[model samples]
Target chain A: MSSGEAGWEERSVARIVPPIRPRKLAKVPFVELAEGRLQGVVSSGSSATRVYVSSIEAETHDFNCSTNNNRPCGGAQGSFHCKHLKALIDEAVKQYGLERVARYLKVEAAEGDDLHSLLNGKLVKAPAAVVFSRFLRHLTYLKVPAGSEPLPEMHWFPALKAVH
Target chain B: MQGVQLAELVQTPPGVDEAMEAVAGFDAALADGLSRLGPRHSEAVDALAGAVSASPLGAAAADACGELAVGSISDTELSALAGARAALLGAVHDALLARLDGALGRTRAEWEEHPADAQEPPANLLAGARSWLRELAIAGWRGVDEELVSAADQTLEALWAEPRLRRLAVLLDGLAAELRVSCPVATMERIPERRWADLWTRAVLLAHSGSWTGGAAAVSGRLLPLGVDVHEHGTAVQAQLHAVLEPRGDGPVRLVRAAVAAAKVDTIVGPEVWDLLSGHPTLLAAIAERRAVDIADMPLTADGDLLWDEERAKAGEPADPFATARVRLPDAEAPAVAPLDRHPVRIAEPVLVEGYKAKRDGTFDLGGAAIDVDADRLPPSGPLTPQLVNASTACIGLLRWDAGRWTLQPLAVRSVAKKQPVEAHNGDWALGPTDPKAAKALARSGSAVAVLTERAGKLLRK
Candidate 1:
């Protein structure tokens, strides 16, 4: 597309799009745990997108996103965002490549969760690229002690990188 | 009787016997003077003139002769004699009058000076007057006239002239009569009769010995006549009787022994032995033994049942009614999640993008936007996660978002590729290693190429 057309098309794309779903590949991996009486599942999609698993004992979490269809999505019924959703998204990105993880990093993914929604779709811009460049420099320079657990999943790092 | 006789003696007639007794002794002195008579007179005549001057008859004759002598004289001779006599008599009378006047004046002066001593009867004069009046009043002397009363009044007045004498006479008279008794000694006798009687009564009361008889009689009337004196006998008698009659201390112990003895008596003989046991000893033993019997032998009625019911009712009283039950909570476990990395995240000093501008010349611009990173600017010690990244970046990032309207994300880079001249250009753009070479080549040819670096692209997509 022409540059002007591209900008116009991006604005239109932003308005019309609902959230993209993670594409199915070969197999999805998952972990099981319990909180109170409810059991939870932490899983990775075929594209290494993270998803959460839960079943109702009394009430369900709003950000639960788990389904019998094996395709992770949103809409559940609890007051607060669920930890299962967070675990699913974080594990998906860490295990898979960033390009394959884009579908899960959509604006809607970070909407209920506090972190990754900050980036949204601003990655195509030059200024956003520069900011991402700076953030990469920061990540490369970051020193983590050996044998330590990885950092807890949060959305703001990439979002801040997009803004620079 | 003597008081009556004395009263009679005082009332006896006063006559010439008093006058004759008054002249009798002076007649003997007159006769002796006549024996020593003057020479010109006959002895008989001298004796007769002296006798006339001294005897009772002679005293009367002398009065007549003195009148004759005055009568026979001539007027001038009598006048001269009378004048001389009158002058002599006047001189003697004047001297005597002066003496009497001095004494009477002294007496009156003392009377006036101590008027109470003079006017009022001395305490002693009152005592004497009280005695005399008491005696006269006791006697039948109803009509003593004012003259006699005046004489008695004058006598009391003279006696009362000296206070000491008046007091002494009062004290003496008081002693003489039992009507008003004096104290043990005279000076202390001045207490009034009422006060004296009170003192005497008090002294008698304090003696105490006389009232003991009456007190004993009163006590004896109440207690001694009763038969309770049997308990007052010696302790040995009580002990001996107690040993023979009731040998043990407790009622049940004595009752059991008496029951055993009674059983033995009944066992030895039949109804005849029981009849022999009908006297006082048997009655008292039976009474004493009755106390040892258990209540099981007694008949029960509604009254007994009520008493027992009351005791049982008291024992089963209900416990406190307002007690509260305790509530127990079920155990709950915390959700299991992956633990956060304990390693702290360190952010270095940020590159100053504004002040170090890309210039055509070698010099850097100091006025452009600057970035400063301080490690101290990090939030206080707590969970360090990627969430803190934006919070820290926003502190230094001069950016704004239109809240609730547009979610615009601003980039931190500025385009400086155009400002670079061809002579100095080693590469067309300053994009880092993650950028594709084709884009770099395109940018070197003065074309706008979108540069994508692997790390930068990954962060953007996330």
Candidate 2:
């Protein structure tokens, strides 16, 4: 095709994509690897009032599952990675990608190991409040109405302002 | 005068520090002053005229202010006034920035802790970019109000609060200021409508620079030959070699992008990206060979992209990035603090979208987020379109907010290429090997006057 006649795929053939796609699903909407922990909010499958805040602390690998108000999860009593935390990782892989989740959690992957397999990190107790609040802050963005007018407060995040 | 000059020399020479220090207080003062104005009225117009008369502006401002005093101004005209005011401030910023730079005598202990800092592009590299227009005899905007050399104030203030963006915004302000001083007498018909759009984008890149420069680091990986993404910025064609860097060891996975920008000449720059890669044989050979290798001793910019200078690198063993099936790609993250819909930086967010289905509306939807294709920035018919056409698996690209929706300009595809499942692929097309086609496609965007390079020579000779 001629210049402007380029098809969509052929057109997008060159865009400065970020290193990779974010690896999280909508089920566990807000996940971030931050402050020595892999933490985020996993939406409640049954009750919206009791969304779970799950976290896995780096180095210690200490994991926690609780409500937004710090109530403990019955499924996460022991040192095992619970379903909520697993879901968080699953989405984290979608949002952040699997490799970054392993690196931040410092997982030494053997050949053909799922994120859970071949990992030697312990689970310990930590607060769920901060991660929950962070998720709440993240939710605020979805409320912003789309418009052509630019927001004065809206600029590229300094953190992502790579040379690219 | 000599005696006065000799007395107690205060080292106040507008250096980088002074320019940076001045930035902290201007926004608050601007906000305060704006608050005092309350609302725009007939009186407000007269007061603005008075302010323009009192300010150190040229004759054009007086003429525009006089016109505003006679009749009610429209919204665009009002914005023009604000833009010109902002531009005047930017001119001041430019003056201070230029004065402060290059005068520090190149010796500072607090900064430049690294010896490689010398290679850092001088802070004032493009600070005075507006000067180019005057030298080249190019026309610049003078605002709808006929206010001298204006940029949209709302657009400028949106970025003015950010120190990094502030540095750039101030320089842009100066750019408008420079234009005003250089050619202040443009007629009302000569002022283009929405002139600031091009200025906003051009000045953003020209004035601001990355924090990290002049440091070499080695990273080895299987360079997934994703694709070459290109953008036509003014007279320049910016092409990026987008790839996935699967580590030689257990290092974190990185999305590597090596950029090659060139001028768009009179002729077409062939259809393929392969011709662009021929300049750097190391990267081209590795991509063409399609093997795992050690890419060593490359300059790392602050934003984490390794500059591909066709120098110092080695080779390594093969490794698969998809062994784990899922990738938690490192850094350049989506704004965690805001929802994707409301995230301010969504305008510049880098996205890797997967599991997205093509909609009948000619858009792609991942879960619920809609992505339209930006048709302007695409390569000419030759390369790969990514996961859309084939197996429609996944793709790497940038996401930009345009019109009213998010537009996707994909760079690479991990789908079925040539009837085989390939992880990362650009396309089947490559430009000529440094021949006429290759030279046509690639011209350095960093070096200004992409279109005028040839035309300018003839203009100057006259």
Candidate 3:
């Protein structure tokens, strides 16, 4: 670290939570902070077409892990997190960094508290239908070919008034 | 094309052909989109309108030249002088540049997509263009000979007919069109310096003409590494490393480019480019990889580009660029707002902008004004990483007006000054031997490029 990095960390970051650890690569392919939740799809280790839709709710730390078809995971039981649910958290940390994920989840993290340490007791089961449907809809975008022709769906995204 | 609403450019990302399509019906679009753009920037359009739409000045120049003709002049002959004066007026230059940008980018993308078609410049065609230029140069003020003009036109027309060659052929044909005008020549210069230089820069870039050394000067600075580059001139493939520097003495901020050319017949953008660099000097490797260096006195261009002369320029010390008191970002000047021409330029204003915010869209959210970037044209490189919006507070770059908003092609970026600032780029790579493997990949190189440099060339010449 250069001499000013310590001070830069202080200035560039808001002190809402302890500075997050440097994030690593995604443990799973997809993760995002949308629908007021840290949620995305994770591929199944043993199955090819099979994907587990996982999410941790923003407000309640309510967690859900199930096959896209609603079959519940064997690992996500009681207070323990399955690998898919943990992968979702890991990827969220990678995407938004540790501090943002902690802040968004309303985790009270102190200095040197890794993500898992901060979110120790804040999880419970939640319905997975909304997230799974959203994931299915999200997969539809992958087929959207690159082009400039006004898209039918995009037409509803009101044209912003021209910048003067 | 009319200058877009700056906000519109920022808010609307192009859908591939958005800018091109909009520019196609530029005049009508301008009338509908923006009634009035900057009058100063309209010089090209106005001049072009005058040139094509029967200009009184062009008529006068034509009439003056028409009388001096030793024989009868054709309609084609008369229009040549007039059109050159009125300009395409800048449209030819703009269209040529845009096409070149698109073509090269497309070719590169295509190669990335389908590596099978990274075809070498069809040598004979390039040779034809080269011969046409040489013939034009030989003809000089006396005006190009008719036979040569006829032959070159045949070749140029064929070049134009080919879709792949269209972009590269634009400048060649443009120069041919300028050279072959049937109007009688006098001792006076025909084209303006701006047009001449503009054509020259694009032409050299297009042709990849090999090696031209600039006048040398004793220069020194706390060289902040900016970008790495590579280009293939006809005879040689050159690798260049660029840096922005603060002079050792009291002077304005300047840029330094260190370049080396290898006599190679292979394509510069080939698979084994690094292997070729492997045997070159340490500095060439450093050029291949943008590296920060601290130097006392080095032989460089008046603009501060390090010369190829090994005995003159000392190999600089490897150091971290961000370990500094401050980072300077010269306020880049935008040409009069012209929609047709992006008029991209490296920054010029002596200004330090700190505490600005970077956005996910590759723009620095400088309060009300935001500078946008196109991942296609200028991907955030060096210290301006993929996470620039999250990482750095300040960005250094080439500035241009695209669509409507002022855009920046980022060169370098760094954290804040209040702390141990971290730059996305530094000179740590130069500590190793000159084996070329140390050079960061995706680096750019050039030949006969010193004449076409952005920030440094402009500053020193002034």
C-alpha lDDT of residue B327 in model 1: 9
Interface RMSD of each: 66.6, 21.1, 24.9
- lDDT at B251 for candidate 1? 20
Clashing pairs for predicted structure model 1, backbone only:
A50-A88, A51-A88, A115-A155, A116-A155, B124-B170, B354-B369, B434-B453
Residue-wise C-alpha lDDT for candidate 1, range B45-103, written one tens digit per residue = 32333443443344443443353333332222222222222222223323332332232
**What does candidate 2 score on TM?**
0.39
Distance from true location, Cα of B421 in model 2, Å? 5.1
lDDT of 1: 0.22
Candidate whose TM-score is highest: 2
Model 2 ranges with Cα > 4 A deviation: A1-164, B1-128, B132-195, B198-227, B233-235, B243-256, B272-277, B287-293, B314-350, B385-391, B414-424, B431-462
* Backbone clashes counted, model 2: 36
**Model 3: residues with Cα > 4 Å off, grouped in runs:** A1-164, B1-224, B229-240, B244-253, B259-306, B323-354, B377-392, B402-405, B413-423, B426-462
Estimate how well candidate 1 is docked, as a DockQ score.
0.01
Candidate 2 local lDDT, B347-380, one digit each (tens): 3323455676766665556653455644334344
Report the lDDT tens digits of candidate 3 across residue range B119-163: 465666656665554444334324434455556755554454444
Q: Chain A TM-score for model 2, please?
A: 0.71
- The C-alpha RMSD of each candidate to the native structure, in angstroms, is 72.8, 26.6, 22.2
Looking at candidate 3, what is the lDDT of residue B418? 60
